[model samples]
Target chain A: MQELKDEVKKLLEQGSIAGFLGMIATTSGVVPHLFVADKADEIEKLTTGDVRYSLVQILRWIAVRHPDDKFGIMCRACDERAMTEMFRNSQLSMDKVVMLGIPCTDELRIACECEEPTPKSLLFGQSTAKKWDKADVERIDAMETEERLDWWTEQLGKCIKCYGCRNSCPMCFCRVCTLNDDPLVKRGEIPSEFPSFHLTRAFHMAGRCVDCGLCEEACPMDIPIRTIYRKVRLVVGELTNFWTGESKGKSPLAELGDGTFPIQ
Target chain B: MADESGSPFEPKIVAFCCNWCTYAGADLAGGMRLKYEPNFVTVRVMCSARVSPHFIIRAFQEGADGVFIGGCHIGDCHYVKGNYITAKRVAIMKRLLEFLGIPKERLHLVWIAASEGDKYAREVDAFTEKVRAMGPSPLKQVRFWKDATVSKKIYKSEAAAETPAGA
Candidate 1:
């Protein structure tokens, strides 16, 4: 925490960034908000808590409209990974930005089942655990085909099409989302089409989902939304020899050229 | 083959064709009067790259029994690398569909150049037979639709009740 404060102090003193993006204590809970910490004194106001929101969405809005200004972001495990994936997908810029990496604590790390809880640069805290639960994926995979289909259909049928899941995801930054497109997703309906609207979004996130779990958290119906994307992530890794945010220079499998690596 | 209801199992398929190659090839097949199944509804886009995996999935949920995507040959994309992306995308989507227990034969990816009119006919004829054998998709199944409608009503009321007055 002390180190992060010092880093923020330096960035503010140097005037390297137009604004600092992080969480501010809200009346309800902690939520992401942009802070222009131009002076050293404002650094005291910044706080990092358990509450999370879609910070990447904010970064995306500012990055597109104001390309000239630089921005500094305080990113944790999933947040940094998400931002990295967003950068690869052309949603965020790496050049006009500074990343203040904070490692996840053991408690938070296990709750998220994060694979990489540390970033390249450490702004605060020491690295903890990297817990991954394959049980959820395995359980779904173990179901009979008919049972699986029925289960998915039943779960998807509970949707009210609030789109809270999509809105909360940092990687879901498409200005013209296909889910809203009439022919593709069938707009103006309750309980959007099963295995189509959600599965399509999941498939699109195959090599791009950073496993942030924001989509599941945002779903009002409490659908196991992360499981779908998590399976896609695994499937892409198995098929294409790539995982999102594992490396910087690698392109998304969906964007790969006509190169086939033998499915091992 | 006719069933008890006398319906011929005419499954609806959506074909995403790249404008430069596959779409022109389809037009060529039309000009040549080559007979193919009319079950397919063609959606022409600038490149097959524009056909996101979501579009194919949506087609199925919106009542398509199958999806066929045709693009320029690997090295011949008009956008230089667009069809390459399409190739990779289709390959991944095929695996995903199979993983979900959707029959692998229901979805097809082919490379058709502007001159492959006869090839286009053969592909469609083969795919039509394949889908015909698979029968109608779950969307057309009466039991599935009945359950879907009932579940949607339950969900609608639950959603309304959950979002209390400005809370």
Candidate 2:
């Protein structure tokens, strides 16, 4: 923790970054904060813990508003992947931002069912080798067609039309979201019409979703949204051999390629 | 066409066909009088890639039991690689639909050349039979406007009653 604060303070003092985006442990709880250079002394308030916030989303907001300013973020493995996907999607410029990667705690690793808990660069915390459990995805895959439909419908029925999943996603940077599109999603509905809202989002997330698990975390209804997206990722991988945020090139869906899907 | 019961389930399938390939194949099928299922209501686009995932979702939402996408064969796309994009989009869409409990078979993507009229007719027949067994889309059963209409009626009456008071 001391090393992280010192690094951030040094960057601030050196005028290397306009602001350092990290989590601050307040009395209310852990919240994301932008520690600026002027108040480098307050870097002591910065802390890395079990609580996860969408810091990359905050970085995008800050970067777009302050395009001229160079920013740094306290990023996790998922955050790094999210940033990579966002950069691939033209949402952020990698050259303008610096990533101060942090390894996730054991509690966070288990809770998130994270495939990779530590970022490429380990700046703070111990990097633990945590393997993700694919039992949930496999369980759904084993269900009968009708049973799977019933399970998803019942699960998605709890969606109060809250866009927390979209709002929390770091890769979701569209100016006008299709989830809010009246013609597509139909406004003024609680559940937003079954299968349409969720299915549309899953399809859109096909090659774009980084499997960050933020969308699932932000869902008030606990829809297991990440599972749906995992299936999407599998499809994208099977069809194009491309995983989101894994490649520097654009998604196959976004670009023309010689590769063909094995459609019988 | 109505069956013996006068209302046998006939799946309403929406087929998005590329103008350069599948659309011309359908025209040739028409010219040859090749028999194909009437379930397919075709929407011709310039290229298969033009049919976005939104269109497929919207088709199901608006009561399409299944969606069929047809494009030129690989390396034969009029736009060079438009069909490749279509293939990727459809593959992802199919996987997503399957995850959502909608059978992946509900969405079909095929490569049809302009000259393959018989193949187009056979593919449509096969897809129609497959979708017919799957039943109507679950989305079609959802009453999207039920609450909206009820609320609209209430608001209209309240506004009508307030007219005299306001004046």
Candidate 3:
């Protein structure tokens, strides 16, 4: 925590960054705050909080407001991944944003079953890369087709259509969400027409999700939305040998390609 | 056959056909007076890339036993490479179906050129029979999808059951 604060302070003092975005310890709790040069005291409050706030979402919000400003922000593996994917999509200019990578603790790695716990740009703390466990997807896949159908149907039945998952997702950057579109997802419906609603979201996350597990955390109904998306991440890997955030540029799904995937 | 209705179950298949190829091929099949299965309906779109994954998912939710996407051969799309994206999306969509425990076979992608009307007719018949063998979709018998309607119906039923004549 001290090292993080010192790094931010140095960047702020040098006028390299307009502000440093990170978690600030407060009476309420550790909340995401922007620390600038004038108010250097706030940098003292900067601490690596345990909670997984949508830091990328916050960065995008501020970046859009101040397009010309060069900003520094803290990032975990998922946050960094989301930012890179966002940069590739032209949502934010890469040169203007500097990342201070936060390494995930061993406990966090296990808890999130995080695919890649350490970000690309690490400045503080010792970090190690861990392989993602496919326990959830494998368990679900082990069941018979009918049994699996029942399991998912029950899971899908729990959705209240609160849109919590979409709201929490860092990759969900669409100005006009198709989930609310009339013809696609249908308006004024609850339990949201089963497989269609959930599958639509899963389809949209094809090459975008970095296995952040935020959607699963935000689901009020306790729906395992991550399993479907994790499956998507795996499929994207299998089909095109592409992993989100590992590289920059357009997702292969959007590109014109030679027909390699067999038509079944 | 032993059920009260006493009629064989018929599966419903929704096929999205690209206008530049598969749609025209279906037209050729029609012009040649070829007989195909009646279970599947072809929806015409300008390009197979236009068939969003949402359309397939919605078809399944609405009780379609099978969803088919018929696009032009690779490098032969009307818009030049539309089928490339269609192929990729369909492959990914299949994984999503399997992840949800739905049989991946329920969704299929096939390339049918404008000249291959006979092949289109043959593939449709095969797909229809395959879906029929799989029987009615599990999603077909869902009673209510609207939460508000279900809740209101529950309220009314409880009210009626509690006070027979509102006495």
lDDT tens readout by residue for model 1, A1-264: 778778877776688888888876657777776777645565676677766677878888988898899998888878888888887877777888899987765556555766676777677677675656678888878886556666676677777889888888988877788778886777767566666777778777877788888888888988888888888888887766688877657665645555443211
Give the Cα lDDT of each candidate.
0.77, 0.82, 0.83
| Candidate 2, position A103, lDDT | 78
Worst 10 residues of 1 chain A by lDDT: A255-264
How many angstroms is residue A92 displaced in model 1 relative to the true structure, after the best TM-score fit?
3.7
Residue A126 alpha-carbon offset, candidate 3, angstroms: 3.0
Error of 2 at B136 (Å): 4.2
DockQ for every prediction shown? 0.28, 0.33, 0.47
Worst 10 residues of 2 chain A by lDDT: A255-264
Number of clashing residue pairs, candidate 1 = 0
Better of 1 and 2 by DockQ: 2
- Candidate 1's DockQ is 0.28
Kindly report which residue stretches of model 3 are placed more than 4 angstroms away from their true locations once superposed: A105-110, A127-131, A259-261, B1-4, B146-167
Error of model 1, residue B16, in angstroms? 4.4
Global fold similarity of model 2 (TM-score): 0.88
